[model samples]
Target chain A: MHTAGVTLQQVAQQAGVSLATASRVLHGSGSRTVGEELRRRVEAAAQELRYVSNAPAQALARATSDVVGLIVHDVADPYFGAIAAGAMRAAREQRLMVMIAATFREPGLELEYLRSLRAQRARAVILAGSGTADADATARLAEEIAGFEADGGRVVCVGERGPDLDTVVMANRGGGGLAARGLWDLGHRRIGVVSGPAELLTVRHRLDGARRALRSLGAPLAPDAVTVGDFTREGGRVAAVRLLRARPDLTAVLVLNDVMAAGALAGLRDDLGLAVPDRVSVVGFDDVPFAADLRPALSTVRLPLEAAGEAAVRLLLEPSGDEPRRVALAAELVLRDSTATTVG
Target chain B: MHTAGVTLQQVAQQAGVSLATASRVLHGSGSRTVGEELRRRVEAAAQELRYVSNAPAQALARATSDVVGLIVHDVADPYFGAIAAGAMRAAREQRLMVMIAATFREPGLELEYLRSLRAQRARAVILAGSGTADADATARLAEEIAGFEADGGRVVCVGERGPDLDTVVMANRGGGGLAARGLWDLGHRRIGVVSGPAELLTVRHRLDGARRALRSLGAPLAPDAVTVGDFTREGGRVAAVRLLRARPDLTAVLVLNDVMAAGALAGLRDDLGLAVPDRVSVVGFDDVPFAADLRPALSTVRLPLEAAGEAAVRLLLEPSGDEPRRVALAAELVLRDSTATTVG
Candidate 1:
């Protein structure tokens, strides 16, 4: 009655040992040990029978499985892809298989996935999605997380979600400041901002930092100078066009992320017929892969994406103390060919 | 007694129903039905007790699981990311969780991941990595696939692996032909080929297709004109440098992939101080997301990567017949600004 090839019962019968002894020798958790002769017999019998160990049964015998769940907003996005790769690398070292689900920026889907991971008895879950500003959704998510933790599953969020949860926080606001200040130092006075959805905490923090930095430099960013995109390349392009059309006096624009920055670069040259650095300088955040491949290359704030993912996984595996743990990652601005002194 | 919160037995007791009735009601495979009154009581008791269903136990009872495995060479690569996004989209529709493993191009790691997925009794596995030319490794992989299928697990390969298995084959050779013809039509006769590892079947097929296409045009590709890279941007840059130093007469180069083509562009302009499409022309395969954002854009062959991923998942969910299923995808040439006519 084995759906997974030969069963352990057959192996035990062939080896002439008790079922407990056969299991102890084959898939034991290392706390128990079997005699060498018995273990050899069991292993040989397993090979002869071509037996495949049932992980479900083993997981039932223990309390949990080797699987860890990783939830992201979009796996196809290079930001999430880099993080998943790093998380997978760390999971490999822990001998844990990672099950990933893309929520596509839907808060409902994120909650559903957490419940599913909890049901699967996943050892831990890494929440790599951005925090939504919806209070109701956040409260519901916090409750669901409590349920998951109650069931012995650990969770580590990659960004700011809520209080009392382990998190690997990126210096998003600081990065925004760096992007603005870099442009300011290049003699760019009238600078515009291209941002993503205001509902995202990341977007809010980054915009706040840019506005503050610009205000201190005596060129306060006007509300009309900021245009919102959907955090996509196309959205960035559309927003850049709208912003530049309205504020023709601006000499530079600060994009919230690299993807949008790439779009702004295209819009500035192809749409508006303006040369970069000579007509308009651009700065972007997140310095994702291929940032340097763009025309004139991109000057962006470097966020250690892979390291953030690795840190989240590490926090999940570490022992929990009385308080939630936080790992702060710093963002640095990298100057490239995209930015230059603004010429009149 | 209940590691995952309240157990089914406790719910059964609270609902005043038989253990069998509780099992048939909650987490049932839908083959049996319980009385409406009993189902209501069970639902109420489950909510009150905060019972979390055990997926492992459910999998054991059903002899299968709702989890599918996806194996890739690298997840950080945008090519794989696009595919994964498609696969995840399809999996979400099917209400299945996908566990992804990156083998990092290691044959041993691929095999190990396969066994792990099998042990977990995953519903199916999608092999998205390129096939290796190693005979021993292929044989071993085939044997493992045989064992996995025998245990009631479905296997679907994304690209060419071996015979007698379902696959969603991308037109690698045809794509290569398209790239070569696109360049030939532009009057580039003295052409060079930049490629990845020769051990990959994809690389071999692509190179063969280009060689055949060029041969038909009476400009046969010479062995000395082809350079091998590690399928990375840096590798492509170094290979382009070496090729130009050796064969200065070549007016164009066909890069195997877009990532490498990006590097070749940088090398041609920065290292060699040559103008694109003026002093040299270049063509790449796989019109990835950032192809258009690159300077002068990239002329390449477009492969429907996301559709390929969706098709694999669809194949896995469909019932298997006597004959193995195959889905062939066509690759088309996309002309951008990267290539131009050869000038003296």
Candidate 2:
């Protein structure tokens, strides 16, 4: 019956061909040859029967699959959306199916997904989520990656998963420096930072770079000037309010990411009733799609996020060398209407 | 040896258990039972050997997989991102892994992905992309869907795909009417529409509703007032510019989606030197995450995108009935600063 999936025997019988010939024409499993006319007959019969080869069975026989796994922290975040799009495009070019798994920024979920993807025998697993600051979690993730690799699956990390692994490193620290230097060059002395969770490597690197730049400028970021929040818009809004409430004299604020920067803009303009640039300047990082459309047109660091995603997939598909390969992408500053010269 | 994947025989030997016992303990296959102590030993042995159960093999034996496939028109679009996030959340609660595939709105790619998912033996498939207006393509998709169902897999369509399939229908027509009536009540008669490709079912239903409402109000949408473009920001920008150049007397514009609407706002404000609401009003649909954050705050129709995504997964998981089930979610109007009374 059709409910049980059409059998290859029926297709072969209908096409008046041998089972081996039908299998070769449809599944292309063995190195076998069939006449052109017979091949067409088998194909026509298979189409008539709506026959779909069992991929799982084929994978079991070959010990590999045509599926690639993309692991992200959150699917809803536009940051990940752009990256996933690039990765999927590259995957399509290779005629491989990309299966995305979102971790929701939970370390446990990330590991669980890694294990699941490994067990599913995905040919390659792209870890696009940021690395965690927790040492134990990092070690466990490294172990999982090792297990995946040991099982003949390739692993590509987007943002510093660990040492000795194929990675596409984004210039997070350099972007942070650029944001701080840009604000400092505009003559803003008293500045605060809206930071995401301290456990994320992205947050740490960005904050560290900004701190170094400000220190070099002879105005170290004060301990009280940094307010940590979730890596979300609401988090940015709330943190901006708290930072400003505590440091009312601060002339500018640097948000760790664009989404938070958007919230910071709303917080400064709507919640605090302050005029942007004239009273308080705001800078964001990772110029996302809507960054240019915000009220003041967010001035942030431009990271070629989509390109980085494409690069990750490329590295994964490339031949593995004795040592893991590294591809670093640069981040540049984008000046928009969001930042301006400070006024007394 | 590890690259070849740890074998069940090795694990059984390490655990001092029989092959059948190890298979049941690790893969949960067959009805054979093992003692509690022996089960723990087998699990520990498998962990020690780093043995990952071959999912493809297990799926072949069980005739299903724990993986569910989600097909979308585009992964980078925030509208789909929101829905995917909701579906993933619901899937996690049910202990199922979700594999998302983006078609990039290509009819051929959509059909190809459906076939691929079916070949992978995905337990269920959630078709989140909008149906096309092409009858031949629709028929092919329907035939492929029937093949998948015949293989004992579940199918859930997020939008109006076909009759006799579980569908979560959004109030596209009603929302279109609401958008038109809302603009009409503001005394805007010469309204232009920045529409997406007319081949899309979503575009047709929304336009149909708007036209019906306008006709009843004694003011039908002029054919010359509609400018169709790609379902993207640039498309909206170019469409808005073209529409306005042709009919400079128009005071309001209706954009099909928020991303394009964002572009329309820029096209009108920056390119055309028109102030939002003051010079011309704009209305958008979908009310994506950044709609409220956009400059001037977009006024649009709000669809329960995430909830709809969750509903699709729920429907797929539920026991199939003799007849297909339908779930319709309502869309409401959200008035923001983007719209105002028309200036005569």
Candidate 3:
């Protein structure tokens, strides 16, 4: 029999043995007692046929491994770090080991890790990052995840929803609107925005929400008021500099993430020689660990990052029905010293 | 043939086969083939006497896996996060996947992870944090690592040296001295120190260095001037508060780490209502990513954390003789706005 199309049933048939006996012999499970002669015949048939079972069948044959896989865009980023920490804590409680892989924001790498985790026979796999803007990458990921699930692997996402997978999503749009409203309430009419990559769903949702808030306040944000950069600190710095140069009249600058906000703070002070709140107020999203410790202390939106991670793991570990599980978390606007009443 | 104490040579002799043929048949290496009858005889003899192979022997029999293991103290800590990022980057370039496990500062967990990695047959294992204070933990780690190495697996340590393993040592003591001297040069004599867990080698090295600096300057650190905490932000806050309450006459405070320094700054401002520099200067070690952006901009000792991580991976990947490799990195003192000359 050709190995490419060989099956366990065919091997069992050739060996003149039952499927269970064949499986027990092939999987090296010693619990069943098969006569030496019969076991040898089954093994010989399997070797001749070169049978290869799918991941699920192979997993069932072996002792189930107690390892869970976690994939993040960047583990060094405090945002993802906080989430991974929570997942690690939960895994420890359940006596499960976590094997984390960093994709570094590359969608291709994410898919590669999923395949690797499947090969490792991990009990579950959690992808923790923003959904990519690449349609092909997204489609491939969806297909891969579907195949993985079919093979008895559980998967959960901790950031934006991806192709109907179980997800714990943050309220990016609402948080953006809340941030804008908070700045507007501080008497800041003229504001600028430091946005992340245009292709990212996070940037789009947040920007849309900010625009909605501006419209509701009867002071819509202009096209010229927005500058985009990578969702990173250096990107934030460059965008902030561009924003200051483009519109010096802006009283406050809203950053999409806390890491970027830190960069903007540096840009305002080092590059523009501008005083925070006095010259240009600053606000950020995602109240990361260091946000409260920043010099002026950041005024931002707080997301339950750790809790989101724990929830994602819980969704994976719990039994699921047909419908994909969805858990949406709310973001709260936290007022700090980074924003102040507009100076006349 | 009795499987116990039955070496492969003895099995080959009993089966009337060459040692090479016995190995090829036993390992199931398809490159070379033997007669079906001969293979059956070898199999029967092996099954009649159960034999167990070492990890390397089992690994060699199977296709080599493409995964490297990284063990960290905590993924949530920025210091470890930065190192993990660098290692992840390097692993990507090599087309090898990284499997990260966080011990959460538990030595027993660290040992458990080592065993897990060995079971996975990882290409290499990197332990990326401080060694435990427990002597037994250290001894067990050394034994495990030695066994792993004996089984043809490579191991590297990234923070403090663990046993005689290859290590990338940070200049914790020298950095501590640098931080203290920086404060001393600023005309502050009466100083207080916020230390991490006293049992940690890092804490001991840094504190000893700071004491050395104080003594060299003809001003010894008073026994009452030191307060120990968990090497965390909250611990820093509590330690800072205790230090201030105990040593009200102090003019400057040196925190062992930047994360803790951020807490000390908060404590000085919120708990004591004291003006930084004018009332009490502050300095710290390990200029993490947010150090330069902290409100007053942290004055700290900058360790090349990412570079250290990269170096650790390089050491593991590169071939070395029986002698262990050692790489020591320097720390630079960064003077920022947080520290100033004390007022009369």
Candidate 4:
């Protein structure tokens, strides 16, 4: 007898079936292949014996649970929402339940969630967000990932890279450079940037790339023209207002992400009374779905956010050896009516 | 010896402490009140014995899991996204992990997800979406929820009412009536309706209420005026195009939700070259965050979606008797630039 006081072999004998057939019936699998009569008989035998399968025990024996743990910075943001949809699609295909936790961009909360996921013995843990520049937090996260892997758990990151872990890296730098070059080529010399939080590696990398492009075009970016916010729509609006106030001569503005860009556009038009592409051109990154529907349509860089999410899950499910796998997605600039030649 | 080969008494004896102290330290609770020296001694004793706490076994003993399960129609939609954020906040306060599953508006998938959540032994399950009109699907869901409750699980529905289950009901009918009357007061005699999937109870209720209000104003709604889609932006766009093509003489349009309203506005301006509130007035339900940011500013009925989500969680966590609890939230109309006096 097992811990539940009834063994599979005994149930099979009582049901006049083989152990494999009884196991299949009890596990709720291979129902189509087995005869209905036999299946009913096995189920009845198990019921008569008061058999109850302990799921956590079974999971412990297999060293894995059916749950896939996903950590995101915030689910309210459209960018994360799109990525989560793609990840959930992949998870559904694999018949896995997803346990999601939002950190709200707090590095400490991210680490805490990792520990909780590890304790739950999740099949895989996917960290979906930009990496924090804090050294202590990074070290703590690396340690947690290493410990999880040592216990035979898989870890994959989307849009973030960690030490010796698989990652789906979005082309934030290249996308930023493309946006800068697109605006500069349009005779936009005096441009402002609506940047997200300065501590995020994503914000830093994109800003650095944009600055590099500006220098290459003989238009050095003014240090005072860069305004920072929380990477939200409201943040974009606030930053845009600050930028306009600091430099009214600016002919164009580049937002870090499409959401913030939407805010910047609204601020420019509603608050500043500026006509898009006529008085002040606007460029954004990450061509979200609504970008094309916005008034005048937003010109932005397209990042394969959904595809990257899928790739992260795929990497987590695939077998791995010593070295970690890496997948880098490209970002392209999509021109729309939001950008045009600077008015003389 | 217990299942793990060591007992709390053994650790207590090894640490030269009381059994309660050892139990508290081993469970990792009350550490703040317990002395540091005593806590370290108990931990060392546990380490020496290589003790591991079986969380699921303990949960089974207590007849509860630490995880909360949430089911949504679609997470990518901003409406659901906002609700999820509110639900997450409530769950966070209880230190519970949330397992989220999206059914994509599939009734079969909804039932299947509930079963999966039950198998995982979730503490509580929150179903957040409009109930389907399919009798068979609704009956199956009710049965599943009943079985879960019988097994000591809690079930709560948000914006959906199941047979004798706790529900957080949004005032869809009243909200729809308010929008219709608001338009009627503005002298909009001929108005088109962009409704969601006809199978959703929310759609039927809202449409019925709007038609009732229209009749009261002596402007009976034509059966052909209602166009249905999947409650999505693209669906709204298609429905708007069809509405315009079929009834070009209409003076106003009311969408079932803000997302579809945004789509209808885009279709009107981009495809039909119609100016909002000038050529034809527009109104939407569910004033999502971006509704006010849209060009011309959408006039919408505001539903406390996030608050409803929070209420659902609260209902699920509270103890209930044979009688189930119900919370109904009020919806109000917010006037904006999208609606105005009909042009001559």
Candidate 5:
């Protein structure tokens, strides 16, 4: 700060402005209360004088608890890790520390993390909904956020939305529909679906989109067309095994996430002796780094997870709740070598 | 805590012991204060009453932020996430919050995190060294730890140890030596080394073992035998390209980590058109989860990363001296499909 060689008083003198005006302009936090013309004049003076803010004061004022909390199902999965990186970047920008806890897809852990976040007095909690078999998770998400709010805690739910809570989510349903439509357009009549935790809102929404897409193509999905998994590789294998067995004639599958896609790929090629794309086209969600590197590069949806994390931070720090509404960001499809036109 | 259904006071009174002993037994903090006979009585009563400790009293006594600070390179890396999980379990046992920060391998951001830890008044700061290129990051690490201590902060470092601080690290060199021995015993010669950042202690140790193994075998390793990469998939690709191009006659390649191993697999199979185990054998470090799932399972060394993280937490919680002794955890080499009897 001293290295700037120009002080606030110098800026005030340079612009023929008052010391208070210069202080307000040079320091952004206080500038909000200053008049526009006076603020501009003070800023011009500071620019002319090459003035710098005091590091000690700036740091002290900006220094928060430095703790941001992330609630997730499993930290071991690469998809969660990718989202965590985004949250980390956001925390770094806000000069905040991050604490991540794995619920292991347990609703109990989700509640435990929320309570701990309250006790630690974290700046915000980003909840990636639990991957589980319970149908009430989405219905309960609002109540969960409400309880946290009652305890004077801030909640930012990613991939889920609830009343009175800040939510940053990807447009998952649209992405799912897009994936289904992409395959449907390729003349595939029998398309199978692999889904995440049956109870999760994302899983439900994605299934809805897939079913809708099938309906649009004049071919409604069968009751047994979709099989649910717990979002782990093992789960993917189990789901794929059953799906393939039930419908050996199925030509394409849209797996819930890329990790599951990897599992599906291995299960098909190695376990079942089926060739990718040629026999069964496989597509996945969440274009994790390894997706492109997989043997027949996986086709997947790239969720802007980092941006969602950043948006959550922005929302938490500058909450504009006069008319708070949920924001839905889009997830784009990234096509690679995973999908090939199917032939009967 | 409320759901325990048994009260500490009742358990103490029933066991004919004082409240402190029962509390200590229940909390598992401050070693067993009750004597053998008395401890037995307390345990018997506690079991009879199914007693549990409330969070309030513990929060009051150890209330001034019982948080263990963790700063790592990437949350997306499965190894670090495993480490974080282990550390969190330890923290939960001790009833503490684990504050985390991801540095993205930026020293400037790391400094900011270190300062943030101090400002937040964390109980201990645990730094998990992330990248390999940081040879002297420890020197810089020491300065930050010193500054935190000067500000009355406690720091415990994992993975990387230094002259000035308390540390918990895995035996990288020993593990590396064993890996080389594994390959040697398997009759593989003319081995190639693909290591992490050459400046890292782990990389240096692994490289030394490879050299020693080759030299002791009475085989002079060609200078062209060693290649250094950034411990990334892309880095592996680039390094593999150069090494394979230079030495088409090489029999095997040793990779520093599993992520890089997957990349080396791609480069050999897809880019370089070489058959694994037949043309060149590949081995990696960390034995991450995905290693076993890859087409040809990876051969790797398993390091107890989680234990290291927990050990660091332990050291940080307790005031240890400046002796700076290394805690050498045991590691084993896991052999799988990636290596064969050097079929020529």
Candidate 6:
């Protein structure tokens, strides 16, 4: 109003295109895919004019929240934080917002919140909660997400998408296999396991990989060697205790998460009085912010949590030609001071 | 309707009163404060017939957005999750809703979001982010909040209100002093400190308290004893290294946060190769979920984040009358396995 004079219509006139065409090119409208030539022209014109679009009107016209629902089991978990960062970046790319819903590991509350989410007219829903105690509970959650889709809502479930739902998941089994191979490479035979909730699909996949690795070494998993926890620090402490009690001769422990791994470390040092790496080695999943900050620099599986979030939002908002997206992000092993070679 | 038929006006008529009086009496509108005879007649009539009032008309007459604003620094921080839970509970009690505005630790973004927050016709704004990096910034934020109040919106800033704010804060300084005194009583000397952002009032207050304790001990803070960080795990590690380098002869380190404390432990062990408790001891603030789960469990000053959120809401919704309401939550030091006596 004061100095710089420019608008989308002006840009459209300069670009020899309609206002809608200009908007499609400028706004990167998710409703339709823009061709390369028009997009480049619109971008150049908008840049020349320094055109700025009002988000509110565009959002109102969409009659949608411009918010993607990111449902996770626990907001406090550092693992989920990575996923959230990814989703936020992707959502921001489309000028969409990300709304987080933490169910606190309760399936019933999650179901109740899903109803409320429906009322918000959310652009899409990304279901990612996995650490549940029962398979039927997750199956029911999947049913609800399926119903949400049936009602013409968009959804992208991670890890375990039901048959009727569209999803973008990681190669969890492969990630687990990688972890197992890393453990095997460390010459860890009598290894103890600290697992996440039994109901979670990732736990099953990771467990399968662990079993496969053990079988490859011609070593059977000792009875009661694997202990399951709720994927919390307290759970990790309790599970570590159980594992150590059952397999005192174990030289290494693999925990499902960094938080629980931190817990297991405390329990081993304080309760069991074991020297890290010298007496026993500890490996954890989910390379959280504090993983490197830990004394032993938790040698764990690093999953692209943030990328998953971003990809989930993109997959939900922009529907590409009918191939159901099964985008599996990469995972890598970060070696640290936690694991020690078995000493004679 | 085959129900107990007893007119409330009958009781009023028998008592020689009008319908309005009968209605008031039967509803027990002023039963406790009004005349005893009127109250008795109202109670008797209400017992005879359960005549419900016209709630629909009252509801029709009322118009409100039934929404509040939750302004937070960053959703990435786990501490905010508990606070959110508390505020949500209070919102449910008040029959209103909340929308979270994530500031991402920027004052300009916070200001921009506040404008949108105001336009949403929010009944109140809950301020949960005070980065403490800029007093002037917070003051400006307070002024903006005051402006919002002038425009008929209520504001409640969490963690302590300044002269221009209505704050529900905690005894952060007192907690810090207590932590310092505990270390002193345990006979630990040559302590290193990890402080929060210098600009934050809460961080400054804690720093002042620690200084006060050191002053009481008739000792001066070593030039290299204290390091400031941004309150992240990475920040903690950076600060811890400085503290250790400055005071290699030091035995104890007090960090401002648990995440930082975890980082401090990593630096102490990985960088300095010091055995915890025997060669070094560490304490942190904020007993977050995983605080106690860490190896050599974090000894921290616990600030009830959730309770403060609930208290803040309660303060904002209710009137304080002649008294200026400033709710101060108490912070307590949780002793755990992390700290130990400095030994040669």
The fraction of reference interface contacts (C-alpha pairs within 8 A across chains A and B) present in each candidate is 0.77, 0.74, 0.39, 0.31, 0.28, 0.06
Candidate 6, residues A43-131: lDDT per residue as tens digits?
88887764545333343344444546777776556777667667766765675655566666668867755644544445677888563
Cα lDDT tens digits, model 2, A1-344, are: 12487778889999999887898898775677788999999999998987888888878878899988999999989899989999999998998888888888889999998898888899999999789889999999999998888888899989877889999999999999999999989999999999999999989999999999999999999999999988999999999999999999999999999999999999888899988878888999889999999989999999898998899999988877888899999999998988899853
Q: How many Å off is the CA of A196 in candidate 1?
A: 0.6
What residue pairs are clashing in model 3?
A: A295-B295
CAPRI quality of model 3: incorrect
Candidate 3 lDDT for residue B307: 86
Poorly placed runs, candidate 4 (over 4 Å): A1-21, A28-40, A43-54, B1-23, B28-38, B43-54
lDDT of 4 by residue, B252-298 (tens): 98999989998999888878888898989999999987787777789
DockQ of each: 0.68, 0.63, 0.18, 0.37, 0.17, 0.07
DockQ top scorer? 1
Q: Report iRMS (Å) of candidate 3.
A: 13.1
- Please rank every candidate by TM-score, starting with the best: 1, 2, 4, 3, 5, 6
True contacts kept of 2: 0.74
Q: What residue pairs clash in candidate 2, if any at all?
A: none
B92-139, model 1: which lDDT tens digit per residue? 999999999999889899999999999999999999968889999999
Task: Please write out the lDDT profile of model 3 over residues A1-344, one tens digit for every residue.
Answer: 01123567899999999888887887655777888998999989987864544322343334245668999989899999999999988887886778888888878889988876765657788988788678888888887776667556688988775647788888999999999999998899998899999877778888889999999999999998999987999999999999999999999989999999999988888999999878889999999999999868999999889998888888878866678788899999998988888954
lDDT of 2 by residue, B1-63 (tens): 124787789999999999888998987645777899999999999989888778887788777
User: What TM-score number comes out for model 2?
Assistant: 0.95
Worst 10 residues of 5 chain B by lDDT: B51-60
Cα lDDT over the full model 6: 0.70
Judge candidate 2 against the unseen true structure and give its global Cα lDDT, from 0 to 1: 0.90
Clashing pairs in 5: A66-A96, A66-A97
TM-score of every prediction relative to native: 0.97, 0.95, 0.81, 0.91, 0.79, 0.75
How far off is residue B117 in model 4, in Å?
0.3
All candidates' lDDT scores?
0.89, 0.90, 0.82, 0.83, 0.73, 0.70
Model 3 residue runs over 4 Å out of place are A1-64, B1-60, B342-344
Candidate 5 lDDT over B232-277, as tens digits, reads 8988877886788998888888888888888888888888889987
